[model samples]
Target: PFVPLRRITPTELATHGARKNASKIYWTVLEGRVYDITPYLPYHPGGEKELLRVAGKDGTKLFNLTHSWVNWDNMLRGCEVGILVSGNEMPG
Candidate 1:
């Protein structure tokens, strides 16, 4: 089941990313969607450092470059936090 998620503004996303390595909760944006990748860090096949490199920032480009064929929606289904809503967009 694909449950709808809340939309978050870029400002909010920036705030979360500003925490850097200190944050207990790490959020990364991919294809306009926000995901809590903290738990997946240790389990990441490439190792946590690779994932941590994009922590609190958009990882869409990196993800696509490295694993475009991967089914991210299914892989990250449980980690999804919200959608990255722009200033001009209305959050539902």
Candidate 2:
């Protein structure tokens, strides 16, 4: 399922993916389907050119891998950071 970007927040990142004293990172979705997205970070078409934008963060790698069937390829364009907004829709 696709989640809106608005629902994600820095605190969420800190709690979920952002780690302490780490420059490289990415997120993992523990549910809804086992998937890991860490490998795709360096390959992010967005270019690792600007590490500042994603420094000490988890790229929510699970989102891409878990939802591959969703054709989320295009969604990667708008992301300024890696975030995982997994699980079913948030109770509408």
Candidate 3:
């Protein structure tokens, strides 16, 4: 599947994480890179509950706090769907 990457903002990211959303997609940010970690959910060693903490938002701080040992760049791999950018970064 060749999904196009996007420039995601905090608000848009928040929208995707809501349970009410029909998309059922989950995204998380690490080091400014946005990942559709939905595919990795079942594989997470910490279980879905812990990983959900980072859903739909920048998880850099919390991820580093717990999984500082993990190399997110390598872990996220193909899941990366975009880059996290402020709303102002979008071209008008």
Candidate 4:
């Protein structure tokens, strides 16, 4: 059974997760939702460009459907980290 992954935000990464490799999880936005695609960073077909688009800001619209549909597997590869909320970052 796969666990549903949690949501995260740029602020969280800026605060702590960006300092290290294992801890450096990045994300992108598709439609109106934010999807954590950090695991796909190394495997991104578009290279670092995709990661840079939303590296330090909200990626609410830069997410490409083609990427999501093509690399959906990478998105589900990791366990749920947590959901980012206003003020709080960890999911409950």
Candidate 5:
């Protein structure tokens, strides 16, 4: 089955990112796309704490600075949670 991808707002993305380690699902935004990285935390080569630092926020800068060589698209394939809705418009 091909389920449609979800479109989330920045506010919603922030809320999910704020969950951090306290929530079952830890989310991160990169290049306007949200990904549930909870499962990859333990396996991250840099270690879980490294990823935790940017758990609930945009990690694009950090990610590029630290491991720009990494194939993020392939790495986050199935982990994608949703796409950030365009512009700053918040859902009502």
Candidate 6:
């Protein structure tokens, strides 16, 4: 099965599952890769609140800040949705 890869822009990424977003589908970016972490909320050791802090935005810095020792790439492989790209990064 081939999963569709998303080229997400910063602006568009900001609305995924933030505080007021109705979708509540918590998407986050880590080292340029986008992940749908909503499904992993219950498994998070820090709890859902900590993940919510990074939801709907680039969480690379925050993720590294607290858990740089953690190998996120492997841990998040299953949750990967796509890559974070600039608005002009993709060509028509």
Q: What is the lDDT of every predicted structure here?
A: 0.80, 0.41, 0.84, 0.51, 0.81, 0.86
Report the lDDT tens digits of candidate 1 across residue range 1-92.
99678888877766666354455777889888898888888889988878876777898999888878988788888989998887677655
Worst 10 residues of 5 by lDDT: 15-24
lDDT string, candidate 6, 1-92, tens digits: 99578778887788886588888888999989999999989999988999889988889899988889999899889988888888777553
lDDT (0-100) at residue 41 of candidate 4?
71
- Whose lDDT is greatest here? 6
Candidate 2 lDDT tens digits, 23-85:
344433322211224455677565544322343344245334544455443434333343345
Tens digit of per-residue lDDT, candidate 3, span 1-92:
99666788888888767376678889988889999888888999999888888888889999989979998798778888888888777553
Encode model 5's per-residue lDDT on 16-82: one tens digit a residue.
Answer: 5534445567788889888999889889999988897777688999999998999988999899998
Judged by TM-score, which candidate is best? Answer: 6
| Collision pairs in model 6 | none
Ranked by lDDT, the better of candidates 2 and 5 is 5
Model 6 clash tally, residue pairs: 0
Model 5 residue runs over 4 Å out of place are: 18-22, 86-92
Candidate 2, pairs of clashing residues: 26-59, 37-61
| Per-model TM-score on C-alpha atoms | 0.79, 0.27, 0.85, 0.46, 0.81, 0.86
Superposition error at 70 for model 1 (Å): 1.7
**Model 1 stretches astray by more than 4 angstroms:** 1-4, 18-21, 88-92
**Candidate 4 has which clashing residue pairs, if any?**
none
Q: Candidate 5: lDDT of 76? A: 93
